[model samples]
Target chain A: MANMAEAVNVEALGAKQRRRFPHINWLALAMIMPSVIALLLIGLYPLLFAVSLSFQRFLLNRPQNNGMFVGFENYAAVLNDPLFWSSLGRTMTMLVIVLIVQIVAGIGIALLIDSSRWRVLNWTVKTALVIPIAMTPAVVGLLGVLIFNRDFGLMNYLLGLVGIEKINWLGDPTMAMVAIIITDIWQWTPFAALIMLSSLAIVPHEMVEAARLDTKSPWMIFRHVKLPYLMPGITAFMIIRTADVLKLFDMPFTLTRGGPGVSTELISLYVQRMGFRIFDMGVASAQAVLLLILCIVLARAYIHFFYRTPEAE
Target chain B: MAQAQNLQTNLLAQQARAIARRRSRIPASAWLQLVLLLLLLLFILTPFYWMVSTSLKEQNDTFAIPPKILFTPTLEHYNFVLFSPSAIVPTGLQNSLIVATFTTLLALLLGTPAAYILARFEFRGKRDLWFWFISNRFISPIVVALPFFLIARDLRMLNTPQALILIYLTFNIPLVVWLCLDQFRAIPRDLDEQAKVDGCNLFQSFWRINLPLAIPGVVVSAILCFIFSWNELLFALILNRSTGQTAPVQAANFMTGFGVKWGEMMATGTLIVLPVVLFAAIVSRHLARGLTMGAIK
Candidate 1:
């Protein structure tokens, strides 16, 4: 996408980019409108309509798009459902577990790789990290399913060598959610590492060296110098990752379909099932509203902390 | 808080000893660092290697109790995916490619100019617009799935390529705009101004000068958009009940079907992964170029 634009731009000075209008870049706007319109109609409308329909009793099978203006009934329904609360709990649990694992593991691996090393090792690690990021979420889920099947999975086979029982990875309500969480971490930890690596490059090397000179331990230097420096990046990644995980559908959908009887069903999975299977748009929209609100809260927090410089305050 | 403090102390103490011991010479821990880095690479890469290996392994090989470290591979899986004897499984590669291509083109057409506008112009509510654009990215795919499914069904176009294409545009378009915005900002606007002063209009400036300079960014976003849409499952699953199921969705359908055919699944998996790997490798340079969007300015 980037190359095509540059290719077009290099043809002339860039006058072809502008519109004929004095105030408006109408021509530029003109070229951009089709996509924006599509985005608005498809992306914007569904989102807006979700909020709109959340207040109504909408059903997919029904001819009517709108239903009775039931104020907060759907919200009440979600709030009332034990399943919703459990899914929320599961999501929160998964969030904490995966976040801790990724953040710690990501920082650890990043630190290890970022240390003085042969260019070959550093390059190989960096290269390996990029491949998973490039893979589709659904593909990752399928791979997990293949690798973790109890009767004949690689994970079980590995466990067998250690004298462990073949675990029912996608089965057994007790462990199914954990399986989803692990799969997510497998796919995303690299993303966390990559972002941290990018920010780690910008960390003040002199400070680290000075700390080293002060007889500060590597751990101490990292705590006082690196952690503070990486804090913002960590928070930024958390915000991004949190929003992403909260919205996760493809992996869970592919791996377990929110199964072992909904134990692994995330809020997104619940909403998707409700919308698609039951055709309950009202309930789905309600779930969506809840999701949007959570997302917005995190996003606001992210901007407040990361995008806003202290000087502004 | 106490545990955290204790952890901090323990970590610091360990670090202090190591640093104090190393500072005298400041000799590099070449072997240790190299080993640690290699371990990290292994952590990142082993699973992917495993995925490719599974794709190559025979049924007996994939399920080998000890997990075959090595095996003779076959193209049975690829044969099944590319040419299934049973017509029950829908052919999705063409639909996926078509939808992905259309979505990319559509996103580029709309996204490039918006990026230009944001990059070149100082409009009222510009920052707000940018925030709005970025904020949309945070919305989960499922949130949009419900209403989209509802509307598409109401239109009676369920299971059609048009529906999948429509749903993809929702996210792809915004991503394009945001990505292109960054790229366009890096491009110097002086050229556009020059072209304008030279009697070239806004569109003329963009098409003739700005677009060409921003191709690297455009291609990067376009490829991402296409790949994502191709791999997309939710909308494809919901909107496509029958004919227009994509490769990923079809692959998933195969996963859940009874009597898991490891060979066929492997073949499908291989088919799915090959294009993405090629796409990444082929356009890796553009990715690097696009990464420096703001800095190069």
Candidate 2:
């Protein structure tokens, strides 16, 4: 057994011994230098500095005492602040609702498209869906403003046709959230659907046919065959959407300005307002760090769930 | 055996008859699906229709209750947005084009080499390094806004297109690297080995063989980068405050200043949305594949 192990090691070492390309490592280093430097300066440095700022006093307006180390104070302040917790809650709420809606709607659309007999219509419908996905978020927000505008908005105009009273979308706090969700759903459901359709396209039809033969019910086939095939795509969509919703700023910024009183203030908007508007850099940085932790934790959980945890036999 | 043969023949006949029936008239299910598709299209297209139709309406017609679907379309809004000397639209469009174009070019330059190494080599700390690159995409741009602002201020790079370009590289590089990594992986490794056996160095093989093969991927990544850079708001909002504002930033500002100018805003939205939607359609398959992290195809 020892001789066999030694032989395996020898073979591994032999395979590791590629033909000498002198200075290749240096060349590779040279090649990667530009990106490495850029990421370091922009990605790594900002992250580190943000963490440092979290432990210090760096208010923009009060620059006299900027960068003074005040460890844990900022964290304490952010923790103690009710607004931070509330906005974080709103952020999570938005993420969950939007994700659930987009995913379900997306799957429905995908299944519809996948099973549809009209090939030309399928192509046309897909192209239409791509429009929302391709629109700039800011523009999407502007479009939302136009659609949901209280008096002359298309929504109200349509509601009037049904003899219903005009509803204030951006005015009421709860309605503002709804408006944001509506815009987000319109923009992102297509993304989820597109992803789902592509994955569904490649699902082996034989299994589906066999399952159909075994059971006449569509739900049974979907549960047994399609859902498993869709799990990875769904998970991917979930990750992307979760990360995006957590950082949603552009929509609320344009639509409501976190308005009527911070009702639609996502964490990104919260952090931006704190740092830029109020000039509370330290606490904003703390909130930013917490936001980061939240994102990483959520992402890690999804990844673990998707990849499956290691098990001992 | 004779009975089974008769059943099989009957089954084949039935299928042929069913095919003939389908050819003769559209199936009920097909009609149902077509209706469903049309409903979804209406839901999807209404907002866009509102944008374009509103853009073409006169200002009074834009706000007219039970909005004008049959009114004479006008280009007054577009004329104001484009031709006015003080119009931010033309300048914003120009800036957006410049910044997005350069960012795509620079990102490709920096990212292609990194993607190649990550794809071909089994180096130390590779997984960690690659993760580090990808995780940048997940980091909220808002989180970096303040720090970026401070750094830019300190460096006297504030309110310049270059500042915006440099800031974009952080996210764009990671994006290009990951997307290009998928592209490079799709390519066979044997080609590299063959090129090497022919006295080509590693760099030469990559430059001559892999880079050319990966052009489709590069084009897809470049388009994505362009769309992202064009659509970017928070960074551009912060980094380019006044003189260097991009189209999206200008559009957002239109909401804040005074009475909402729906017509002009819609025009701007239409302008920004048009190029990107076109780009997306051109590479829709690649975009979807990349969004799936190349897990689809």
Candidate 3:
């Protein structure tokens, strides 16, 4: 076994040597330098700055006492603040609910589209899905504003057409959250659907056919065959969506402005309010750091749980 | 025995014909799927429809009690949004175009070569470097927004289109790198070796050989980069408030000032979304991979 391992290592080393060309390493480093430098200046610098700012007492409103090292005071304050906790709770609620709704609806829609026999309808639905996914979130929010208008809005009008009373969609707190969720679902469900559709496309035709030959039900086939193929893509979508929802800002910012008295205030909005609106950079940075940690942890956890090597499988 | 064999074959043929007939006819479940998908399509397209329709409606007609389903559509709002002197959108659109174009160009210039090296070369710390590039995508914009604002302010670059163009690279370059790395990987390494034998340098081989073959993927990346830069709001909102606002920021601005100008806002919204949706449709086939950062593909 030791001799075999040594032979493999020698062979790998020989392969590496053969792959190398004269002056390649320098060229590679030179080629990659500009991007690395750019990222370092813009991306890494700000990240480090935010970390440093989190440790300091920096307030844009009070420049006189700026940059004073405050240890964990900002972090402690952020943890103690009811607004922080509430906004975090709101964010988690949105994340969980949005994930569940989008995943289910997306998979359902994808399955329907996949199973449909009409090529035109399939093409049309797939084409239509791009609009929402491509729409600018700010515009989506603006559309929400117009659609959810109390008196002249299309939503209320349509609701009234069904003989329902006009509901103050954005005015009431619960309804405001509901409105945000609906707009989000409307915009993002397509994304989820598209991902699932692609995943469904990879479900082996032969496998399904064989399953059918075995007299398996469609549900059984999907549960046994299609689902395993969908899991990785779904998990990836979950990670991407989780990162997005944690930083959910643009749509809700324009839709409710964290309004109806902060009912719709997500964590990103909270940080924006603290950092930009209230100009409390220290606490905001602390919160940003915490949110960053949460995102990394969740992403790592998801990968750990769902990500498996093909060999392992 | 011959009669029995014939009868069995006849029964099998009858079953095949029955199955074919069933397959040819649309099932109830299929019809149900059609209805559900049509409704889903409607749900997806309604906002777009509303935005365009509202953009065309007159100011008074915009808030009509029944919501003007059949009004004479007017271009007055579009006229005001596009041609009027007080319009914020055209400049916003221009700034958006300039910033997105430059950001794409710069990101391509800086990222494509790096992506090539990352794809083809086996170097020390390659894994770390690749992860570093990708991990940039995971950082929230808010975390960087404040520091960027401060840095821009310190450099006296605030409210300049250059500020946005430069800052957008922080994300766009990573995106370009991530997407183009996959593109470069998909190309055969034998092409590079052939170019080398023909006396082409490393850069020439990349520029001439791999890049042409990877052009489709590069264009996809470019389109995605342009769309992202075009649609971004938070950085544009913070970094470029008045003079350098993008179209999305301009659309959002309409919400903040005075009574909500639904007609004008929708007009702006329509304008902002039109190019993105069009571009998205053009590249819709690759969007699943792009959105997932090439994980699915």
Candidate 4:
């Protein structure tokens, strides 16, 4: 084994490798120096500084003399607060709901598209679904706002045609969360579908044919074959979307302002309200660190079950 | 001889069964396709139709006893929003454009080269560096807003275009670098090595050779960055005043007025939403790998 490793050893070529690839082009490094520096100072340092700020009171008015050590007190405070707990609870449940809807829609749509041998319907529906992806969450939220606007919104207009009473979408607490969820489905179902469709399109034809030969139903084929194959993409996307949906801000903020009495206040929105709106940096940073931990933990679990590790983790 | 005939009959029976099974499922398959097609149409068209229909309604007609789909459409709302004495509609559009242009230009200017180096060079902590940048996503925008609030305050950059440019970079740079990074990396290193040997300086090689190769990705990234910055409200709201608010923030503000300016806000919403949706649909449709500059996952 050692001898085999030595034979294929990459670093063994060392000096010879440098000579062969001999173009470090220090000038590229020279031009890159400022940008690299700027990224470090601007992009990187803020993250580190923010983490530290979590431990200290970096309040706006008290900027000069506010470096008192408060060890986990902020985390403790956030934990004890019902507002944080509830928002987090809401965010998680919402994540599960949105995720289930998106994934099912994604897998189902992909399956439909994949099975249809006809060129016309297959191409048209797939093309149309991709349109939702182009719409930003902000625009989607605005669209939702227009639709849900109680007095003169499009949704009310539609309901009027049906003889239904106008419902308060952004105003009522129950309706506010529903409004956000609908907006997300509008924008992101396409994303989930597009990614899943790519993976589904490549499932081995022979395996599917063999399954069919064995008298498997389409549902069974999906449950047994396509599902297992699509797991990795689904897992990776879930990791991304979970981290994202947890930070749901733009849409909710725009549509509801976390209002109708905090019904739609997600965690990131909660943190922003604490940090920026209230200028309570210590608590806000603490809130941020806790969120980071939650995200990392969730991500680790996702990586474990679904993502093949770089180190096979 | 009898056993061989039996085996041949069984094989033919299996083939027939397979064909029969397929034939039986054909109607069901067609029915399934029809149902899915209807769902797809409803899913895509409902909101779009609703948007145009709402935009067409009279301001008072919108809140009618029942919703009016067939009411006579009027240009009154559009006229009110666009030409109203009170609305800063033009300023909002201009602010969005200026901020978006500045942010996109700067991100491309700085990000493309850095993206190139990170993509090509095998540097130390490359992954960590990449994560360090993309991890900006992980940091809630609220966190960014807080520090920048101080930074902005300290420099008195509040409400200034430069502040938006700076704070916007907190998120936008990583986005640009990540997107451009993949494109830059896809270009073979041999191209750069050849440019170096041809007496091009590092900047010259990067600008003259590598850049042209990375143009498609850069333009796509520029579109994404512009759309994001244009639509960005958290920072735009914090850093700029009403006079300087980006289109989305401005539109959002219009909704906060007494009883909400439904018509005006929708008009502004339509303006901002249309371009971005089209751009994403047409330009940034590459289902390729993310534009990460080699470091971040």
Q: What does the interface RMSD come to for each candidate?
A: 3.7, 3.0, 2.4, 4.3
Give a tens-digit lDDT track for model 3, residues B109-133.
Answer: 9999999988887666676677677
Error of 4 at A227 (Å): 2.3
Cα miss at B146, model 4 (Å)?
1.2
Residues A36-110 of candidate 3 have per-residue lDDT tens digits of 999999989998898899999999988999999999999999999999999989988988999999999988888
Any residue pairs clashing in model 4, and if so which?
A: A160-B67, B130-B296, B178-B291, B178-B292, B179-B291
Chain A TM-score of model 3 versus the true structure? 0.89
How well is each residue in A140-184 modelled by candidate 2, as lDDT tens digits? 888888899898999889889899898999999999999998889
- Mark the 10 consecutive residues where model 4 chain A has the least summed lDDT: A304-313
Task: By lDDT, rank the candidates, best first.
Answer: 3, 2, 1, 4
Error of 4 at B52 (Å): 2.8
For candidate 2, give the docking quality class from DockQ: acceptable
Candidate 3 wrong stretches, greater than 4 Å: A1-24, A298-313, B1-24
Where is model 2 more than 4 Å wrong at Cα? A1-24, A301-313, B1-20, B23-25, B295-297
In candidate 4, stretches whose alpha carbon ends up further than 4 angstroms from where it belongs are A1-25, A58-73, A117-124, A149-168, A295-313, B1-28, B64-66, B287-297
Clashing pairs in 2: none
- For the second chain, the TM-scores of the candidates in order are 0.82, 0.89, 0.90, 0.82
User: Mind giving the per-residue lDDT tens digits that candidate 4 earns over A53-75?
Assistant: 88886676557758788888777
Best by DockQ: 3
Q: How many pairs of residues collide in each model? A: 54, 0, 0, 5
lDDT of 1 by residue, B1-297 (tens): 999999999999999999898765545577677667767777667777787888788888887777887788777666666666763333677778888898788778777788777677665676666666666667788888877776887899888887877777766776777567767777776787689679998887888888888887788888878777877888788778677778888877866658887667656666676687667655543332222221111
- As for candidate 4, its interface RMSD to one decimal place is 4.3
